[model samples]
Target: MSYYDVDAILTDAQKVPCTFELTVPGLGHLEGNPGAEVKEGTKLELPLWLAQMLAITPAGTKPGMITLDLPDSLSQKVTNALRADPRTVELRSLAPHFFNLGTRMLDLFEEEELSDLLTESFKLRAKELADHAHNPRGALGEGAEFLQGLDENERRLFRATHEGAKAVRAWLVGMQKK
Candidate 1:
C-alpha cells in the first residue's frame, strides 16, 4: 500500500526508449551517439534520462529545437477517443505510465488533445481509487474487478490505494482497542 508508486512507474518506464532530437548546439554527443556530434536535426534513441535532459535543456525548449516522439499506441487511441467524447474512453484502460510519462513531457504533448483529456481522466480515476479505498469492509466490487484487469501501472495504483486504506483501518482499530 505504498501511497506513491512513482518508483514502480519509473522502473517500468525506464525500460522503454523515447525518441528525441537536439535543436541547439553545444549539448554535444550523448552516450548513444558515440563519436558522433549531437546537433540540430540529429535524431537519436536513448533512455528516458537523456531524453528528459534534452527536453528540459534551455535549447530544448526552443520550438523545433527539440522534438519528442513518445510511443504509446493505446494512449494515442485513448486521446482520439477522448477528443471525440470523454465518455468514450474507459478510465481504467488508460495507462498510469502514460500519465506519469506524459506529465514530464507535457511541453511536447500539450498541443495534443489527449494530454488534457488524459490528465482529466487520470485525476478522476485517482479520486475514484481513493473513494474505493475508504470502503475497506466492502466486498470486491466492480472496482476490484476493474483493478484486477488493469495493466502494471493501473494495478500498481489500485494496490497502493487499497493498501493505504487497509493500513488506516488497521490503525483505527488499534486506537479503538487502546
Candidate 2:
C-alpha cells in the first residue's frame, strides 16, 4: 500500500511566520503497519529540522509540546502523518493567551483550530491595539478609546462574555456542590 491511516494529535503548533518552536510526539505510527514506510516517512521528517530553525519550548507545564519559532523540516512529517486518503486530523491550538488584569485571571476562552489553521485571531486585533495604543493616545487621547470604551459593538461582546461567564460559574457551582 502507498499509504496507511492513523490518528495522532499534533504535539505542538506549527507557527512559522513568527517565532514559535516546532515539536512532535516522540513515537507515532499507523495502527496496521508499524515499520513499513519509515524510510519514506523519515525522508520527509528530515525537512522539519530546517522548518523549525528558531524553536523554543513553552514556558508552562504542558507536556509533549514544542513552539515553532522559525521554519521547521519536520512539518512535512506532520503533513505526511496526516496524509492518508480521505484523511482526518484532529488539531488543537494553544496560541497566545491573555491575562485579565482586573480579576487577575488567566484567559483560555479564545481559540480556533482547523485542519491546517489554529490561532487566536483576536490576538492580532488585541496586539494591533497594543502596538498602536500610544499613537492613538497621542493623536486623540480619549477619542481613540475604541475597545477600551467599547461603544455598541464592545458592549455586545461584553454581553456575550457575561453569558459565557454565567455558564462557567454555574458549572463551577455545580462541581462544588458535588
TM-score of each: 0.50, 0.20
lDDT of 2 at 16: 34
**Candidate 2 on 100-140: residue-level lDDT in tens?**
11011112112222222212323333343443333435325
lDDT per prediction?
A: 0.55, 0.31
Residues 34-79, candidate 1: write the lDDT tens digits.
Answer: 5555666655555555555545545544543345576453356656
Q: Which stretches of candidate 1 lie over 4 Å from their true place?
A: 1-45, 54-66, 73-75, 82-96, 107-109, 112-115, 135-141, 149-178
Candidate 1: lDDT of 81? 62
Shift in Å, residue 63, candidate 1:
8.0
- Residue pairs clashing, model 1: none
Q: For candidate 2, what is the TM-score?
A: 0.20
